[model samples]
Target: PDIELHPSDKAASFSLVLKGTSDSRTTAYKDPARIYGSSHSEFTARKRLEITANGLRALAAEVKVHETNNEILGADTDVGGLFAGMARNTAMKKARERIPDAEALAARRVRERVASRLNQEVDASVTSINRRLRQGPGAALEQHGLGPASLAAHSTSKELVVEASLLFANQLAAGSPPAALPKGARAVVQIHESAVNNAIDQLGLAGQTIEGAHVRERIAQALAPVFGTSVKLPDDPEQQAPEGSITFAARAPLRVRFVDGQIEVILHAASLQRGNLKTPAQVIRARYQPVLAENRVTLRRQGDVEIRAAEISPEVVSISLQGFAAARDAAIGAALRAPMDRVFRPQINSPKAFTITTELGNVVPLEVTALESRDGWLTLAVR
Candidate 1:
């Protein structure tokens, strides 16, 4: 099959809402310990933020300051200290309750104090998204994507609200389909073994090994767009079967295995080849490791699949090449690099959106109201 590639100037508009609560405790006065008792105040703030291509904006925020409790844990009839603690606690509580919108007022004061640091955080997040969507494989976002970024926030009696719009260059592409959820449908994905197996089969390696002579033909057919003119698979099995073909003994079996924490497609006795250098097939396993472990594929709970370093066992595995073992090992590792770094591993028969027991409504795309990871599934609420 022949295919043509074209540059896409298409863009997507989605809203990401982040909501959470923060708990804080601090000493009311710096020298409280010297007074034979500790006086401390505790506060809780509930914050909601709306983030868009424009920037991050506060939705609503609510803050509450608990009355100070100035009491010594152990005291030998320290009547003065006891009364002082009681009086201070009573006074603070009364003052806070007596005022209208006290929590909102307090939240405003807190926001003002941390405004500079908060703005910096928002800026940093926007910068990161911009950098990711504008570089290398991510550059498919086209040119000058994110626009006119700005942040706005305010406090209310119930909570503090933040709204941000990160303006980027975008135009509605012609006849673009809306990613709306089907009527009465939900947004939960269950990635089963069959779905994974099918994806692997699409790679044309279901019954073949990387060392096969015809591997390049299969790879070229599957990934012509990626490797392009530089594509090559120089290593061939020692025992040849036919021209541009691999021996039946060199074939490997592939299966998707579901383990305790994640799902993996294991290619038994797979071959790893870089140019003319070949390494053991087991060296090509894809374990979803963390981002810090950049050597391996960065697999997070987000369900996105990435290519990373496979595991290498201590057991002596045979190398096909006669010389340059160390250099060949490195070369083999480089060749097995992930073809697609970040891609949504879609679940078969997945829902468009989902509703959580805690949330009042269904979550959908365009507006991702909520996100939860439960029962090994990443559940998302969309609007």
Candidate 2:
């Protein structure tokens, strides 16, 4: 490839053609990987081709720089001849002669270079998406108070779509989902995971669900002597245990389920662990609704926000939160102890107050209709 650059005040430019031929008997040798059932030979060939291509590019650049210098310094044509002689020295001649087929190698390099460039462009385009905008509908939007924490992008004919299950993790203000983009431009997006996680954290539930069998297993593990080798319990999400008991240690994943004005928790081993048990496995089947409520704290799902005693309002450019005391304490602790986790956190907390905020940068207005829960994320739907 040859390129010409116009002279600037500080420099001059020259066009140079990389001359090479692609016909070579050496490449007739089959890449060993194709025969040996491995890709090693193919990889080796690609590396060699890249190295050769880069060397040629450097050589061409050096020649151009010298040419520019000669023109700038007001040197005559004789100086150009001197540079040509130096570039065509014995080493250059031998390097060219040693190559089996320069043109064939250059051809491979061109294809690889073009493919690399396209891959880079695709990555850049996908990463450009704005978080608050571009939520699409699917099974990912079947639940309330769910919004995508991140997106996995795949290219389409003119836009990119996420065909996989997307996890949502935050609350959104009740309104239309944000629009995707204008036409005739590369479609891409960025997701705000931390912002969503913060909004969802107010609920104290974070949509965590565990089956009864899992709870049983955890209890058995805690009381290994009484439960023996294995433990069994119901696997249904809505099913509860009756007339059973088991003990477990603290810090097990406690799940809270809210139905009407009541709250039920599973995997809570605090009460059972206090007594000695003969039927340890059988005791694990009891499901008790706990009388747990925080003063001035409300847990409810509205659109994409899980209410946990906070005042949140969504605007065209930003979502505002006030008086989320619990979320504030947790975030501050996380920031002070595990500061590394906040390195890429997009949601910003105000030092002056417990108010948190995040903004949508330059996106079209769209309506958000539904939110669904996925593992670690919520999916948002636009209508």
Candidate 3:
């Protein structure tokens, strides 16, 4: 697989394509865990941790929820997906029942009320903290260049801790049942011990290592038990944030649901295209960038020759396909030739969908589509 990253300014984003690769082959060769199993212990452990962390995160979630609740309720608030997540959970249902027509207008209203009450409580705490940091005791620090104790500053600081904590808590609470361990789940099932152990460990430790790390970090200085673990949570948006730049992390491979089964493409490269090939002294010569750090840039790139067919009218096929956008200069040239003379229409290949067109600006659709880079050019029957 060839991978390349062109800066957005340098080029329009290219969708990577994998040819002659199947999920079976990938599963057997690349990621067996994804194909056969996942971290079940981590998942189970997460549920347990979420329950424990609820108290920790609730303190923060409540404040932020309160701050935004009133504003959202008063405005055109849509809690459309907020509670959609655990709609099956009884706690969520009961929480929503406090407001009538939760499926309609009242869901946001209920949330608003909750958020408003919590906001008032948060405001009170902020006020108390500010007073102490000001004249109560820490006046010396504020007077010096160290820090100034203002209610706003105190609220901001508290907000960060509470917000981060609540964020983790909400994740924990997300799939939680009204109670833990339903009575019927105590059966001793036949399964691999390693698998069961793995699942359990995931359920217990994954969330803490990933998101709960923030709370652990904030209390790091004072807590002695928390050793060797950094308080900084990697998934937290605010932590280590470069100014004005947001970071998005990919935890796993992107699973694409396809018609036959499912096709998973591990795109190590930003844009996946079949590199153009030229032979230099019996070696394939192509110049392009490979996505992998180890294979960053290739001096002479060689790639498989793809089949391309164009079916535009001889007169205007050149203008129609060339003018239409393309993946490469070769694509533009192939479309300009209008080679597919016998088919019903000009067939342009696309991985997800296919479009058929003519020189007269008429378009026909085909179910059997092809990838843009897979084939060079195949002209179809022009209607």
Candidate 4:
């Protein structure tokens, strides 16, 4: 079989030419005498059949994304076959001459059979491909709270090129089409900051609040070793904490922004309370530089998280308590940084995060070769 691809902007067309031959033999016997059977004669017929199918046209179909699965539209193909040749034995010469245009009739029958078989095979292949797609990439996208926003496919002389844009679930499919994949790269994934934020929203991290008692307990646990003693923190606003004890409460929503070749996480706290003192709302910005590793891309924290007081003076406290304020700010920063790192480390640093499995059970590991973040898009180049 020879296959050729013709690609246009909207869809790709394919033509297939198939050639094959088949041979078969048949035997028949006739008894001359009934009761006193005297003799029997046997006749044998052999034939070699050749068929060629040309202009079998197949077109790349449109793909639609659904909630539970995907749909393939216009998956029909046009098949045409011709009976090229047929070799018959001498024993079948008399039978062949008895019918008018016997060869032509045989050719038509063979052509019909070939066309039917080809159509069946094409249908089966399409069904299998559709099922595998739904089970593999479709399921994976849903797992990450993403779906295809738009899809287009075209056939080049060498291959079929497919381009698709992804959107977070429930997000409106409105955006400029993504840029083409980088040359020589097997695959590239371009993620927008809004998509990341949507995933975070799916995780229920936005507007999450930590109770003061829970916050104080975690702080004490973290500072116990540094202070060389177990710390007891009081959460009541009216109660006074011991020298090393602290109480904290925060309600912050996590958001991500892609800018300047880095990812900046903005944790804006709407309410923050420390024991009897209620501090003004603050913005905790953590910048991460994306670094490409052997099999994954990780966001490494650029520096200590920046704590900026929102709508207030730079000083976290009065001048007289400068020393105490410095220590308090350090502890609070440490507390905030730990959990954020924990939440992001597995997602950003693990090689499995860049791996995908096909329905055929083939594992394709995306080895990160380059990473770039700018203009609200984070692009990863994989080999």
Candidate 5:
């Protein structure tokens, strides 16, 4: 539904009217249930906005001052000055409400959105979808692309509920209880009562939204792009993925990130070891960070040992070398003259193999499984 706003300087002038449904039938978003329900209310957009509260505060404060000055002017000035005061007050009031508190609120909203995806929402949503995909009469886990060894697995009969459901307040707390009733949830999601509590015990949720433009860019990456604006899930629920192939405009640089997957790589260019570093570092390191988990790699350099740039599976497990030694890319450039200092391992497992290659692949076997993996994204294929 197209909403054509009347440009007027009065509270009475700015009011919303729903075009499609009765007042009783609208969703909490006041959206009518239509198959093609593309039209969303401005109120709905404002709800997700991080700065709505601050804008309201700024408005109330500014308006009180504006109205008060108009009164003082009426007492002291000529009718002309009084009329001018009224006009200024009206114009300011209209502009103030119309123009959102973009800067301060934008910053806060982005933080909230990223937090929702990372700390609160993304995991729940993935669980919901995975549950739905898992459902069926005797549905095989392989049908959903999951093998039997998926650590703890969800049953095929299970269903899940995941949605953004815009709200201005009480966006569910970090790890709150499951939603009491599912709204606008798909039939694919069979979240019923008796099992709801149990499911909540088994599953988890985090809060999230599309907030900062930069945050939006990150959300787009961590979660794949659904449309121009919507986000889909990454391969790993607990990991933040990089923006796939989105070009950034000069005015708006694209930054790929997510709420909880704080995987980033930084590089310093030394004329001694300067390479096409920063961009590649962020790219390659993220490629492996999900593999690195939260652990830092501590290399023991007996004397300038060779390191190979390795590949992580698209699902972030099992590194299949395009045959290892062919990877001559400089993993690090340490001179043997300096008594060979190993790159300090943070959460990195101590990988020692014949030449760090061979089938032992040293770090590859040790770093790939959950027992040795850090943070939340690691798995080992049970033999």
Candidate 6:
């Protein structure tokens, strides 16, 4: 058997050719003949058969995509075992012609036996292949929300080819087509920024308040350099404040935007408190350059986080110098940077985050060969 592959921008084609030959010899008794007082004469029959089964036209499958349910239904052209039957018939005709006594009943029996065995072999091979397909790639595709949109098979001078177009289930409703796999890459997964934001939303990060004694302490420490006084952040908003201490709290959901080859994280609102006085909400914007190394992808902070202050000033703390707008913004940005880094680093930098575990319990470590963020999409090419 020979196998070949042809790949195009939209689809991939595969070809298989099965060819073999068999020989057999049979000893039988002929009709009674008077040969030196012998009642019957014996003859040896030999037959050599050559078989070539081309799956170019015989083996074909079509996959219909059901986007709503995220399912793929396959329709095989050889549902009736037509290819196996044809191969059996061809083998039988050739085997019978090779036999010395083609018209003999014995020859007919031999031909039938040869054809039956060939048919069984062909049928078994086809069945086994189909079973493996269903259990292997088929299962993987379904698990990953991938379905074939179009399937076609054809033959060239030297090969039989099967071509298919595949789609991602989640992208169908958005009318977004799958990107072409990069040259020499085994697979490519394109993640849109919107999908990332949606996942964040599903996790209930939006409107969620992040506050704790340890969290407040960390932020307070980060602000110490600019405040010139040790800050005390209350763990709860309603808790009584210590004298001259300032409280800071940030609210999510954090939204991400991919553009200009970077990931921009926006924290919509943060508030600063000094006793009963609280400043208006502020926005924090952070940008990161995504970096891929070995099997891990991580984000490197591009620069200092941008702090957008509201009309009310955060410099009203009695322990700090008043009316210094720039100093207040810098203090808030510095306080949030470390906590944000802690939140994102572990999530994206781990190698296990990108590893794929297959249904057979095999771990496939993905080595990201290329990473690109453009046009609101983050694409990763892996081998």
Index of the highest-TM-score prediction: 4
Candidate 3 off by > 4 Å: 1-102, 142-383
lDDT of 1: 0.36
Steric clashes per prediction: 42, 25, 39, 0, 17, 3
lDDT of 3 by residue, 243-283 (tens): 11101112211111111211111111111111232111111
Tens-digit lDDT string for candidate 4 (1-383): 45555655555445554555422222322121111111111211111111111111333322111111111111111222442112122223334342344334434444555556655655455556566555655554555455555666656666545545545546533254255556666556676776555544544334545554354355344334322345654233434332221122232255678889898877666655545544445576778888866555566778666765544465745788767766766666555554433323322353524677743456877666767888887777766
- What are the models' TM-scores? 0.27, 0.18, 0.15, 0.47, 0.15, 0.43
Comparing 1 and 2 on lDDT, the stronger one: 1
Better of 5 and 6 by TM-score: 6
Alpha carbon lDDT of each predicted model: 0.36, 0.28, 0.23, 0.48, 0.24, 0.46
Which ranking of candidates, highest lDDT first? 4, 6, 1, 2, 5, 3
lDDT of 5 by residue, 129-238 (tens): 44543453114323322222211111122222122111112222122223332233222221112122122212111122222223324433432211212343223233
lDDT of 2 by residue, 1-383 (tens): 33333332222222323332222122222221111111011111111011111111111122111110000111112224557455334333444453445434444554465345434543343333221122322122323333333433322223334322223333332222234443333222222333332332332332233232343444333322211223332233433332223233233323333333223223322332111322111101112222212221222222211212112234522434434544663443332222111111212121111222322233443333333332222333332
Write the residue-wise lDDT of candidate 6 on 175-231 in tens digits.
Answer: 342445456655566666655544333333344334432433544443333222455
Which RMSD values do the candidates have, in order? Answer: 19.6, 22.2, 32.7, 16.6, 25.8, 18.2
Identify the superior model by lDDT, candidate 3 or candidate 6: 6
Q: Model 5: what TM-score?
A: 0.15
Encode model 1's per-residue lDDT on 1-383: one tens digit a residue: 11112222221122222232333432233222221233333444444343334433343334344443333322222235558676555545544453344444444555544444444554465566556444532342122232213434433332223332322234111121123323332232223343233333434454454434454355445433221223333332433422222211233344444444444543344444444544454422333322212122223433433333244543643555334555655554445433212111222122323344312234423433433322333223344
Candidates ranked by TM-score:
4, 6, 1, 2, 5, 3
Better of 3 and 4 by lDDT: 4
| Candidate 2 wrongly placed segments (more than 4 Å) | 1-102, 105-153, 163-180, 183-383
Instruction: Please list the residue runs of candidate 1 whose C-alpha ends up more than 4 Å from where it truly belongs after superposition.
Output: 1-12, 25-105, 110-123, 138-383
